[model samples]
Target: MGKLTDAIKHLIIINVIVFIAPQLLQLDFTNMLALHFPKNEHFGFWQYLTHMFMHGSFAHIAFNMYGLWAFGTPLEQMWGRNKFLFFYFSAGLGAGIIYTLVNYYQFNGIYELFINAGLTDSEVLSILKSGSTNDVRVVNAITQDQFNKITSLFNTPAVGASGAIYGVLVAFGLFFKDAKLALIFFPVPIAAKYFIPVMILGDLFFGMTKYSVGNVAHFAHIGGALIGFLIALYWKKNQFKTN
Candidate 1:
């Protein structure tokens, strides 16, 4: 295991503080800092950045901070603090943007269905806000599945550093393609080049399908990996290094 680099150390510290401080203080920061749907009342432009520093639970922060420390140490060592910070935030921001875009698409698609079925904007908003519809017309306008999806899209907030850490994993793979890594579920060691792509592919498959196990923001992970791969590939091709 590599020693904690400067950037990764500070990041983990911040994450820990953010995770614990709110609970101790009996304050909730989710509505203010977590990434919410664009149409949601709680959403703000700054959430794209702030949400990276927020985490949902102890296990969530633990897993993400571990990934950051493990995979990001080598990256911060290779690219100086400034460059590493730039890359990390870039990937995180990309993840948020891509995630929002995907949600917007889904929201709009269902919205059009409601509009085509002759529901007014106010009626649609009421249904979303109240999570119920007394009007049979509104009920007939959209299926239960569509209603559930749209409700979840608006109500659920995305919070964590997983996106940034996913980027770190990609960079690690690029820098140490031969490095062997294994997951808890699958303990067999595999080279970074092979493992990272397969992991990302799994995220993509889960993101596109309804078979995902939990409340995973799979698209955010895929977005981070995509941005990280692009940036790392460009740097590799040009032989770029911060130091």
Candidate 2:
């Protein structure tokens, strides 16, 4: 909205650094910093926090940082640095955990199908890891589509601050419910209260269905919004007490 506050400035600087440093140095931080499937070998505990700073592409980081600055500026100004930091990180962690839980459910459902078809644990793991099932029984038990989904889920690592940015967007909506906003594709301005819920619903619809536009982690966005809403609600209700 105006010049960045201290926390907002520092957060943007860190995100930019994380985005640019690896490319400049020709270093790969995907396995170490990007969030991966819990069952994947490359999965790391620290990625839940670190992945918030990692991004897949320039457009991805640009959008996220812009959201952070645009929406986060008011919140940081209202809540001050420490409180804003707590809310931001809490939403991000919630996003990672929720995303992982959803993946686990889907992965295990497919895994159970494999087990029910008489494949052993090791055999199922082997098939998932190798992305091939020569055994007639395994092939007949699960369709190629199912095999591909589980494999892609296992191998594709999630990066970027979209989750945290989604959290900021939600908070912005709550704080400035009447503020006009619009998406790039749909530029007609709408009140934040109306627009944000629609946005989140779109994510939920895409996350549960097969129509997701890109390699987006929709559930992460949902998770962050959920956490942001709860925290912002609590703070709003207890505003006098906190102050």
Candidate 3:
């Protein structure tokens, strides 16, 4: 195997361990590591880093690891391990910040909608805690009563390496702007410079459109790309003076 960046390699190994932990050790640690939005009572400060290693499903881990291997090796070679690691974590953190803010606003909007419909304090609290509308049915005898109280406070947690991957995507586009990469499942080859921006734009459009199958955190992807692009620009400008 070619020499891999320490940080990237470490991250990959951790993700693999976590993904298989439940299957091998019979421990469901994803719930503990996944980053819950700030409104969640269970949220902890460490989740920002831990969540990057947690994946919701096999496809999630596979896709993320594939992207990391595809883009990160070249990035580490170009930027060195430390800088690459910094960029990766920073982008992931930025994604979490953006996702939190957006979720907060959405929660508020939904809260107001429920209040307008005459939901009481207890009722409102219930909806927020459970993360579901009145239309959604509550299951299980134990949670039935607390359903309304918890729903209001309930915020869906985001878990994945997508943010970091997006950072790598941005780096690939910026450094290899003219390099051509072919899309899987499609035979056509497209330049990285063109392909990456198009992907960002498409995410933004669909994110706003609220299209079905658009549950993916498109803004988080955009947030990571934006931060990555800015960091790359700064590095480019300072390269001569620093070196």
Candidate 4:
């Protein structure tokens, strides 16, 4: 409701710098900043926090920064800068952890199937490392379908602020449940309480069924929302004073 608070401003500045620096400096920050599967060589512990500030495109960062300024400002104002930053990073790290867990679940199934089909761990690791098994010489009859699934899972790296923004969205709904809101996909005005849940449920459905239009990390979104809900629930019960 007021001018961009300190934490929000710093976050936006950092995101902008990180997003642009890659291009200006001709650096491949993705390898270090983007969240990757734990088994991947690119994976690192710092990525859990860094990935929050690394978005995919202009539109991606723009939308997330807008969300940060829009929903996160109110939260920062209420929670103070330190607590807000802690919550923001917590949600983001939690999202990455959950996203990785989900990836493990999905990829493990494929890995196990290949193993049962006579593919060795070394063969699977090679496939994952190469991001493709098409050229790899394997004795197992790796079908095109199976190859595609494994490649997709191994190659898909998540980079965005959507997770923490989703956390802010959850807090917004809890603190301002009656606030009228709408999404670009559905512009009709709706209450924040219902709107947030609908968005989370959509992510859940897509995450569960593996039916998404783009490279949307649905599990990360849901994970952030879940953590945000827990934090908000705790705060609300304790009646954290904003004043």
Candidate 5:
């Protein structure tokens, strides 16, 4: 416990503080800090970093913090504080970028659909701008409007540290490939290298297949993994050159 890396310690502390601040101060800190995808119009450039520290619920924070503690301390120890922080923020930022791009494409598709269905340009623009259609009748009456409203919410904010944690999981897999990890409350043990990738692939499959799971940003997980893998590859190449 005392051997935890400074990065991990500070991250845990901040997450805990953010989690409890709302209850203590009676403010909706998470909603305010969460990363609203670029299309939100309300999105700011800083949310990419801020959202990783904000979580929606107790269970959400618990799972994210647990993943961070389980995987992050070891990676931080190996990579050192500055490198770990860099990798963490990089992964989180990458996640936000990928999520925003995906949301933009989806929003455009919906926008085009609404336009094709004879909804006025203003109506479509209103949905894109505010994410509220204001009339369920319009949605029910026009299939395209329903689709537009549904996809508009996709542009809503994504809040949590899971993306960065997923990046840590990737780093752990690469550096501690043979380390055994056991699922929480389960007796089965699996190697970190294989386990983490499998989990990532599972997330990809589910993310692609299921779109209705509200507020879970699975593509951001993929984005984190991709960034981690690329960073690891770059370090390996540079190490070879240095040697």
Candidate 6:
């Protein structure tokens, strides 16, 4: 489409290229690029930025890149290249930060339970290191839930651009409040101001209830949307002053 701006084109190109490179080249980008939990051995500082370019499946990358092109083009046209790039990465980093904070709280809950179950600090650390406890005493001290949480916290790697795309979606809604949107479930179009909030609420419900059908990162979506909203709101308020 003629509306596809320069930055959006490049962003989509890079994402698709990186998404295919791993499979075609047999290179392992998951460990180096996907966002891993902070305590996980695969966690690295670069993951915050790199994770935005890594996706798990064809559907995952396709939908995210589509969202970027659909929503990001106008934002890039309005903000210019440098500012648009800054907003994109800033929203992504913010999404990662918030997602990690939520994970930390979940981990702390398990940490307390493990402590109460009589696992020593070192024993807990060992479990984190090895991703499991062979120690019978440690195994018997807690419910199956504890083990599952510990395993999930230490081993699950999040890979996708959904968080950052959610950011772009939020920005689109804010900038084009009256724009009509249609969803797959609801073919009838509605104004973006109404639709985006509903979408975000759906994600919140899913995240809080753990209502995912698979390995979905609902909170990351919420995080990106929130960050995008704040950034767009701030810019809206200060636009006159900046100009």
Model 2 alpha-carbon miss at residue 151, Å: 0.9
In the range 69-161, model 6's lDDT, one tens digit per residue, is 878888887888778887888889988888888988988887887787788887787787777667776676766777776778777888788
Q: All candidates: CA RMSD in angstroms? A: 1.1, 1.4, 5.3, 2.1, 3.3, 2.0
Which one wins by TM-score: 1 or 6? 1
Query: What digit string (tens of lDDT, one per residue) describes model 2 on residues 187-207?
Result: 999999999999999999999
lDDT of 4 by residue, 83-132 (tens): 89888988888888988888888788777777776778887888677866
| TM, every model | 0.97, 0.96, 0.83, 0.93, 0.85, 0.92
Over 4 Å off, model 6:
128-136, 240-243
Candidates 3 and 6 compared: the better one by TM-score is 6
Q: Give the better candidate number (1 or 3) by lDDT.
A: 1
- C-alpha RMSD of candidate 6: 2.0
| Span of 10 residues, lowest total lDDT, candidate 3 | 136-145
Candidate achieving the largest lDDT: 2
Which stretch of 10 consecutive residues in model 1 shows the poorest summed lDDT? 129-138
Model 4: CA > 4 A from native: 134-143
Q: How many angstroms is residue 76 displaced in model 1 relative to the true structure, after the best TM-score fit?
A: 0.8
lDDT of 2: 0.90
Better by TM-score, candidate 6 or 4: 4
Which regions of candidate 3 fall more than 4 Å away from where they truly are? Answer: 1-3, 116-122, 131-155, 240-243
lDDT of each: 0.89, 0.90, 0.74, 0.86, 0.76, 0.84
Give lDDT: candidate 6, residue 49: 90
Residue range 11-88, candidate 1, lDDT tens digits? 889989988999999999999999999878899999999999999888999899888888888888888888899999
A best-first ranking of the candidates according to their TM-score comes to 1, 2, 4, 6, 5, 3
